[model samples]
Target: MSITFEINRGDLAKAITIALKFAGKERELPMLCGINLSIIKGQLTITGTDRFRLGLVRIRPIPETADGATNPDLDGPGSNIGVLPRATATRLLRVIGGPLDGRSPNVELTSSGRELTVADGETRLTVTLVDEKFPDVVGILLDEMERPIDLDLWGVNTALFAAFKDAAWRKGDHATVRLSTASRPAVVRIGDHFIGCLMPVQIAKRGSTASDWKEFLTSEPERPTRTTKRASRAAK
Candidate 1:
């Protein structure tokens, strides 16, 4: 059966941007590397994961009428699902998603057989879909990966590394900082001097070395590297 629907570019693009972060980058889990778009119970859910981190967002797609009423055309309550490969997601985001604002037109998405197409009723992009099935992330999160949980391991945003470097440079041209290995808000220090604290990003392991997710959503945190990136550079 061919499943078809329309979604606001702004909403869909924003959701895809967040989901891309969780999408698998490695080939180890080829199936988990793509973005999953599914509609269930009148809600559109977009998800992406790399076995280490999972991100999903639900949207009850509805349109606002002149009288402030809701448009029932895409008010969820429908079934249409597809997986956009990493490359495809990137391309789609770059194409229709770029410069997207609330006024951006709605995009039509059609999934038929092994193909998925995204267009705005004029120019269209039709690509082949992945064969792998997306896992029930909501179910997994409800049980296996519960909220308000504590673990030794934590994820850090790679972007913050620059700030750490900037702080060290500001302190001294070649200041050597000691980063404390903690679960959240990793403390950055320069000798006995405290620099700042950075929150944990969505990381799988606390260690520098790669570790498998023991059982899907579970992992044993490993000891962090003795020397941080900037520290090692200063030592050299």
Candidate 2:
């Protein structure tokens, strides 16, 4: 079946911006330097991942229709996945303008095997799909995780985001944000829609408290105050 669909440029751009966090950077794996766009169950899913982190956004497009049925032009069965160069995709989305534009731009995507064409009005962008298989980003994301701390999306994005950066500075790189019952400091966890593990900037050393030191100091019996007979004899 032919793979072609038109999506609201503004909506597509918003989704891309959300997923761009996972897009890989230069000097990284070429396959990771692209965004994976796929159609599954009538939803267009865009995913970007640098292996360490993943970002995904799903959009259900409904073209203007007289009847309240799904847009046949954008709806189809089965799954079709394609990788688009991140740079090209980003540029294309940016050109589409925001949702508040005087005229809503429509971006058309048509796929032929390894080539996917993106067209917006008169402008068009064609990007080659990467051959390398993308790692299971979803699996990594949904893998067995401690129950996440539920918080408002805005709070996490704003307050928690700044806190994470500050912690990274004090704790150094690769600090882990451990989520566990034993963790005294509150660890923020959101719903399934958004999950993030930030490396902790600083972690208190376990068993380093003054009370712990006092317990250790008093736990052991005092070393025998009496000197050994052999030492005493030597001294004599």
User: Which residue segments of model 2 deviate by more than 4 Å?
Assistant: 63-70, 73-80, 98-104, 145-204, 207-236
**10 residues in a row with least lDDT, candidate 1:** 187-196
Candidate 2 lDDT tens digits, 55-127: 5567766565223434555454646466777887777666665554554366777777888777766667777
Question: What TM-score does each of the candidates earn?
Answer: 0.56, 0.58
Candidate models: Cα lDDT each: 0.61, 0.58
> Which window of 10 residues has the lowest lDDT sum in candidate 2?
151-160
Error of 1 at 146 (Å): 6.9
Backbone clash pairs for candidate 1 read 42-77, 155-201, 155-203, 156-201
| Residue 9, candidate 2: alpha-carbon lDDT | 72
